[model samples]
Target: MIDTHAHLDFSQYDTDREQVIEECRRNGVQFIINIGVDFQTSKASVDLAEKYDFIYASVGYHPHDAKAMTDSIFEEIAQLATHPKVVAIGEIGLDYYRDMSPRDIQKAAFIRQLQLAERLKKPVVLHIRQAMEPAFEILRRHPGNYGVLHAFPGNAKEAAEGVRMGYLIAFGGPITYPNSQGPQVAASLSLSKIVTETDCPYLTPQQFRGKRNRPDYVRFVIDKLTELFPRYSRDDIVRITSKNAARLFNLPVDDSPELAYMIGKSLYLNLTSRCTNNCYFCPRNSGFHVAGHNLRLNQEPQEKDILTAVERYSGYNEIVFCGIGEPTLRADLMISLAAELKSKKLPIRLNTNGQGNLIAKADLPSKMRGLIDFVSISLNAQDETTYVKICRPQFGAKVFPEILKFAKDCKEYGIVTIFSVVDVPEIDIDACKKIADKMGIPLRIREYASD
Candidate 1:
């Protein structure tokens, strides 16, 4: 597994740095990202990356160093990022825990680095501690392509927010400690939005407490992760998180047929491009892409056209009811078409806004009983206020209550329910979890699509 985060640039590893790298290699640790906290360490990080194949570097000034940062420093960071192995531009963001740097300086430096990452087209490795709400404010205002929250400190509520923003949360050693409440919150999140990190020489897991951390201890993090998240295998964790890291950092990956990812081989029937909500951050307006696939819909396809598309990929894994618009808006045609696919014994997956039950004003979940193998619903917010601001639903607050009811209905019908929330900056993830847990269904927090 990749230790996507580490700070070998610190003096903590000065005595036996080479030995540490050797040990990491022996332990099957594929990669280690040595993050920089300032200009000097950032350069050292880049230098170390150049000397070793397995070690990559992330160049940025930490919040504590923000007070000393200047415009020239950003230029230097941009230049250092030109190094081939430099993967990100952070260890940036706020740290209310120390407040060593002035809040104003921290914010300015953080925003500057964010702009640098955007200009460099690189992902950031965030380090927010006891400042999620304010950190989120900066994030919402300067929503770039993507980044990760290294050692996230908020509850499931914050995790959901980060996930909605298309950011991955990197869990370090503290997760193994029995008393670490922050790590506990992270463990409860979906594996898709999580990546394991050692954050070596700091935040050591329980076993290595009071001892200097090492890259080899990544296994402990994975082992604990497996114990917490039983649905995922060790290999699955490596695959998913690595892929997410690769995507966020824009690392070139092997795209062989065996490695290429697709939700299913099924036909994805395009319904409509029009949406009821005009979310401020919706890709439909800013950038129309999903999973790197272009999703620019010019004209709506007729039912016959959709059926023809389905017939073309009939040997697929399944037929998915999905599109940029609400699939249920064409509910009549969808039910009829789904029935046709069912007759052919084709599996079906429905991606809906979950307003179908309220829109049709009927028992929609039961209507999907045998027609769908899985139903993925968008549970975008924790409360109605944020929901209105983020989703901007045409139906207003009505959509929020209706979606929750829809989740419960889907569970009762024995349909595989996926309750998805977006990574908007302000939503409460823990509250959403309470709702999902009460209803007894799986949850997915979607990353915000970027331009």
Candidate 2:
């Protein structure tokens, strides 16, 4: 895991700083970005980065100390930011909650630092607190800047707005607190735009609350993320968050494609990227990434190649024939793989857009009976017109009734069938739920992500 925000250079770590960093290395922390809140801390952060290869630095003046910032200090910060080890210009922006610095002085410092970051071509680590409106106003004035909303204090809507503006939403220890809005916001946004941090020597995780925070405790943050995103495994969280930090800080990290990826305890197979419908709400519309796994395949895998991929994993609760694309496009391969996987004594599930029978020109549901244990069909809209408008099926509006018929056939064939709909504005979730109810199937409402 990567701790995107930390202040290990502070006095709290003066006694056992080296020991804490060692603990981070032992705890699987691949990288840590030490943040600079003022001139002294910024230089210290750079020194820490120089001392350790895994540690990077972000040099900037915190809003609380904005009043002390002068032209000379700003020039020093600009020069410090040029260091190869300095990855960003951050720990900056407005902080009205503390009111430690005059609001006007804070805004000026924030803008000056933002301009510096923009000129340096580095992402900014925003520190907005109870000043989101003004902070967003400044961000709007400077449209091209992109970075993270560190230790985000805003609601999901505000977080969504930041994401729309090309900034990532960062979560820290406060997310682990009971009755906090962190989980709600985390669940609302896509994991692709989320990154984890510890904000060491400050907001500690619930398990370690009332004590000083450390970079190694980032695992607790990852644990909270796992709970919020049950579809992704702990390792998946590490991989994805590390990738996000690496991208923002331009750190060297491995990010490879996966043919079979696990979510929760289920292993999902990516047999093909070919699909029958082009759903506007689909993540593929924006990118091929889902839960951090790139589902865009250069070549469709055969039965042997899939089995080889599956052999690398173990302890999965079930096998799911699902990817960014429609698995049913490779109906024969899916069935053959399911049959092969039956010996593993694990249940199998198929996530589809309910166009299998139409594509195969056969009773695909009946064909799946006994081989596929559960099926999740996409019931995106309540009626044919809505389906055509949102799904854009290759077979057009005529394919809508056939999708309903397909769900019915799955149930008739004794498969545990479920319907799913993305909660996009174009979709009437209640109406879709009613359709699922009438069909006697459960409806899963997926949160829509504009990113």
What does the lDDT come to for candidate 2?
0.91
Candidate 1: where is the Cα deviation over 4 Å? Answer: 182-184, 252-255, 259-451
Give each model's whole-structure lDDT. 0.78, 0.91
lDDT by residue for model 1 over 16-115, one digit each (tens)? 9998898888888877888999999999999899898888899999999999888887788889987889999988999988999999899989998999
User: Evaluated with TM-score, which candidate comes out highest?
Assistant: 2
Residue 451 alpha-carbon offset, candidate 2, angstroms = 2.8
- Cα lDDT of model 2 by residue, 1-451, tens digit: 9999999999999999999999899889999999999999999999999999999999999999999999999999999999999999989999989999999999999999999999999999999999999999999999879999999999999998999888999999999999799999998888888999999999999998999999988899899999988878898888888777788889987555678988778899998888898888787886687776778888888888899999999888899999889998999999999999999999899999999989999999988999999999988888999999988889988898999999999999999999998888888888988888898999998777765
Candidate 2, position 116, lDDT: 93
Task: Please report how far candidate 2 places residue 309 from its true position, in Å.
Answer: 1.4
RMSD (Å) per prediction: 9.0, 2.6
Top candidate, metric lDDT: 2
Worst 10 residues of 2 by lDDT: 254-263
Report model 2's TM-score to 2 decimal places. 0.90
